[model samples]
Target chain A: MMSFVVGIAGVAVFSVLARVMQSAARGTSPVAILAIAAILSHLASVALGIIYVPQFQYWSAASIFSFGVMSYVFVFGAVYKSVSLEVLLAVAGHPDRAVPLPYIVGHQVPEIFRGRIQILIESGLVEQIGSTFAATAAGERLAARIARLRRMFAIGDSGLYDFPD
Target chain B: MVGLVTPAMNFLPGPAQTAAICLGIALPLLLLCYARIPGIRGAGSRFRIGCATAAALFAIACAVLPGERRIDDVAGGILLLATAMLLVYVFWGLLAWGFTLTLLTTLAQAGRPLTEEQWAAAYTQGGDIGKFARNRLKLLLGSGMVAVTGDTIAATSSGMAIARLARLVRLATGLR
Candidate 1:
C-alpha cells in the first residue's frame, strides 16, 4: 500500500516535471518528455521505497506506476489532436458558448488539418512536391503498415469517426 | 525483516512465469498474423480477440505449469500481461485511427502530388470538409460535449469541462 501510494505520487511528479522540461526540449514531443519523466520518477520512487520500506515489493510498485503512466499517455493521446474535442473547445471558448458553422468549417477544421499536415511534413512522413504534397517513401511504408493494422482491427482509412453506414 | 527479494516472491514463478513471459512477447506477433487473416473484421474486435487469446493462453500456462500458485508470482504474471496488452493497444490505436498517420496514408495512396482541392477531395474520398467536420461533430454530440440547435452548436456544461481540461493539458504539455 505504501509503495502504491509512492508510485502514484511519482506519476504526479512526472506529469509536472515533464511540463517543466518540455520548454527546454524544443525538438522533443511532449510525449517523449513525459516518457522520460516517467522513467526518472519511477527509478526515484523505487530507490526511495527500498530505503524507506521494510520489505519493498518491486512488482507491485512497478505495476501501478506503469499502469498510471499508460493511463496518462492514453488521455494525452486522446486530446492531443482530437477534432471533436477541438470543436468543443472552440465553442466553449466563445463567450456566447456557441460558434457559427461557417467559422468551424472555414477556420477550425482547416487549422487542425494544416497543423496535422505540418507535423507530417516535419516528421518526413509527407513532403511537398512543387505544386502539391505527397507521401514520402517512409510515409508509404508506414501507411501500408497502418493500413494492414487497421484492416486487422476493422477500422477505415478515412480518419473520420465511424458511424454505421 | 531484511531481504533483497520480497518474501512472497522468494518462491519465484517457475514454469508458469516463463510461459506468461513468452506469451506476452507473442501477443503482438499474433496481432500481426491476425491482421493478415481476411475474415477478421473491425480493429476493435481483432484487438479484443488478441487480448482474450493472450489471457486464455496465460490461464493455460498457470494451470499446466508444474507448480502451485504463489500469490506474488501470480500477481507479477498478471501485471506483466496487463502491461503488454496496454502497450499493444496504445500502438495499435495509433495505427488504426491516428489522424496524422491516416493523412499520410491518404497522400501516399494518392500516388502523386495533389493540388489543395484535389488533396481535399482525395482525403475525404469525395466528401467535403463539412462532412468531415460533421463526422467529428457527431462524436462531440454523442459524447454529450456539444449541443446543436438548428444552425448553431454550443458546448454543454460537460463540454466546458472538457474544454478546460484540454486547455490544462495543452498548457502542461507545452502544446499551447
Candidate 2:
C-alpha cells in the first residue's frame, strides 16, 4: 500500500514536472522532457520509499509506477502524432461537422504530409534540397535498422491500416 | 500517517514478480520465434500470439509457484506484465507503422532527390498521396467514427466524442 502510494506520487510529480519543463523550454523534445521527469521522479519515489517504508519492495513499486508512466507516454504519442485522429478532429471541428472529399485529399492530407516532412527536417533525418528532399546518412542508417526490423517481423512499409475486405 | 511508517510491510511480491519478469523477457523472444514460423502471416497476428503465449505462461507460473499468492503480489505481477506489453507495442508500432519513419525509409531507398509529389508517390509504391489518404480514411470509416456521403465526409457522434477526448489528452499531456 505504501509502495502504491509512492508510485502514484511519482506519477503526479512526473506530470507536474513535465508540464513545467515543456512550458519553460519549447525547443526541447517533449518526449525527452517527459522521460527525464519520469526517471527523476521514479528515483525520488524509490529513495523516499527506502528511507520511510519498512521492508520496501522495489519491484512492486517499480512495476506500478512504470505502468503509469508508460501508459501516459502511449496516450501522449497517440494524441500527438496519429494522422487518423487528426482527420477525425478536423471533421469534428469543422462548422458543419463535414468536409468535402477533395478538401481532405487535396488540402488536409498534403498539409499533414508537409508537416511530417518538416519534422524530419527538424530532426536532421531528411534534408531539403532545392525543390527536392533526400535522407541523410544518419537517416539512412536508422531507416535500414527499421527496415530490418520490419522485414524480421514481416511487416509492410506502407504504414497503412489493413482493412479486411 | 501510520500507514506511511508501517513496519514489516511484507508487500514484497517476490515469486509472482519474478515470474512476470521471466515472461516479460520471453515476449520478444517469442515474437522472434513466431516470425520464423511460416503459419503466422501478419505482424498483428504474430504479436497477438506472442502476447497470448506470454500471458498463458504467466498464469501457469502464478499457479505453480510455491507460495500463497497475496492480492498485492498478483496485482503487481499483472501490472508488470502490462507495462511490458505496452512498451513492446510502442516499439513495434514505431518499427511497423510509423509514418515519419516510413517516409525516411522510402527516401533513403530511393537514392535520389524527390519532389514532394515524387516522395508521396514512392511512399505509396507508385500510387499518389490520395491513395494514402484514402487508406487512412478507411480506418475511420471502418471504425464508424466518420461517414462518407456522396463526395463528402462527416464525423459521427462517436467521432466527435473521440475528438474531444483527444483534445483533452493533448491538453493534459502538454502537447497543445
Top-scoring candidate (DockQ): 2
lDDT of 1 by residue, A76-135 (tens): 777777777778888998999999878898789988888888898899888887879988
- lDDT, candidate 1, at B80: 69
- How much of the true A–B contact set does each candidate keep? 0.59, 0.81
Candidate 1, B39-151: lDDT as tens digits: 87667778889999999999988887776886655665776677778888878777766767777888888888876567777778897677778788888888898888877
Pairs of residues clashing in candidate 2: none
Clashes of each: 4, 0
Please report, in order, the local distance difference test score of every candidate based on alpha carbons: 0.77, 0.87
> lDDT by residue for model 2 over A62-85, one digit each (tens)?
888989999988898899899899
Considering every candidate listed, which one attains the maximal TM-score? 2
lDDT of 2 at A149: 86
lDDT of 2: 0.87
* Candidate topping lDDT: 2
How far residue B64's Cα lies from its native spot in candidate 2, in Å, is 1.3
Report the TM-score of candidate 2, chain A only: 0.94
DockQ of all models, two decimals each: 0.50, 0.67
